[model samples]
Target: LLSRLYRPLRVCGVVANDGQSGGGPFWVQAPDGVVVKQIVESAQVRMDSLVYRTIIDLEFLKHVDF
Candidate 1:
């Protein structure tokens, strides 16, 4: 018998609140019908939306830990 892995096989860096850090996360549908998580930059996001602005304006007093 084989044991199934409960946790994700890999975890990639997603969008961070800080302007200086990493890229953002987006959904990608695979040809096999599985949705994949991808990390993207600001260029991928629409700067015209209020939602995007809200995310950029969010404050962070300290470094967050996952």
Candidate 2:
């Protein structure tokens, strides 16, 4: 199985949050169904929105995707 896997993968890095606000690595799905990594900041997301709230709740409620 390992031998059959030849696709390159990019790993995202994480660190301890120190109360600082800035962009962080995130996996964003494109219109064509391609998922790309990009830096996103808290300000860029609407914390009050239902979609964002559901995503956050789901992330903690279940096993996260790698």
Candidate 3:
């Protein structure tokens, strides 16, 4: 998965199956070797939504000089 993301230089969504019907975790490693993990438990609401949203908001603020 990390290889795929690196090749495309984009975010990828993943779903894991263990035959038990539950959401799994997603992970990404930065170019500087920082690791990030997101544990998702339900399809209704992602556990990483708040983190992703905050990152987006921060980027927006930087772009707008806010």
Candidate 4:
């Protein structure tokens, strides 16, 4: 039963934000200063906040290949 249910997963590409709803790949920095890839959710972040704008302007979020 487990064998029959087993399936491989593949990531084709990232889905960009449409300004409505959706989440995709993003680079986030940890409190320890270690940057890592995370699938950030739109609801988890406030898109219209000043901090968000500052992060974008500073290029804190980066694009990376998996």
Off by over 4 Å in 4: 1-20, 50-65
By TM-score, who's the top model here?
2
* Candidate 1 residue spans exceeding 4 A from truth: 1-38, 61-64
* TM-score, ranked from best to worst: 2, 4, 1, 3
Candidate 3, residues 1-66: lDDT per residue as tens digits?
776567644454654343465544545465878786654455634447897546433433232210
Give the TM-scores of the predictions, in the order they appear: 0.38, 0.46, 0.23, 0.43
State which candidate, 3 or 4, has the greater TM-score: 4
Tell how far residue 13 is off in model 3, in angstroms: 20
Candidate 2 Cα outliers beyond 4 Å, as residue runs: 1-16, 50-66
Enumerate clash totals for all models, in the order shown: 0, 0, 0, 0
Overall lDDT per candidate, in order of appearance: 0.57, 0.60, 0.49, 0.61
Error of 2 at 36 (Å): 0.8
* Model 4 agreement with the true structure over 1-66: per-residue lDDT tens digits: 475349774555664434555555667888977785677666777869998756643432443346
- Runs in model 3 deviating more than 4 A are 1-17, 28-35, 42-66
| Model 4: lDDT to the true structure | 0.61
Instruction: Give the total clashing residue pairs for model 3.
Output: 0
Question: Residue 24 of model 2: what lDDT?
Answer: 54
Cα lDDT tens digits for candidate 1, 1-55: 1332665577655434655755655565768777766665667667799986676
Worst 10 residues of 3 by lDDT: 57-66
lDDT accuracy of residue 3 in candidate 3: 69
Question: For model 2, how does the per-residue alpha-carbon lDDT over 1-66 read when each residue is reduced to its tens digit?
Answer: 464357776566555444466555567887877687665677777899998757644534233333
Candidate 1 colliding pairs: none
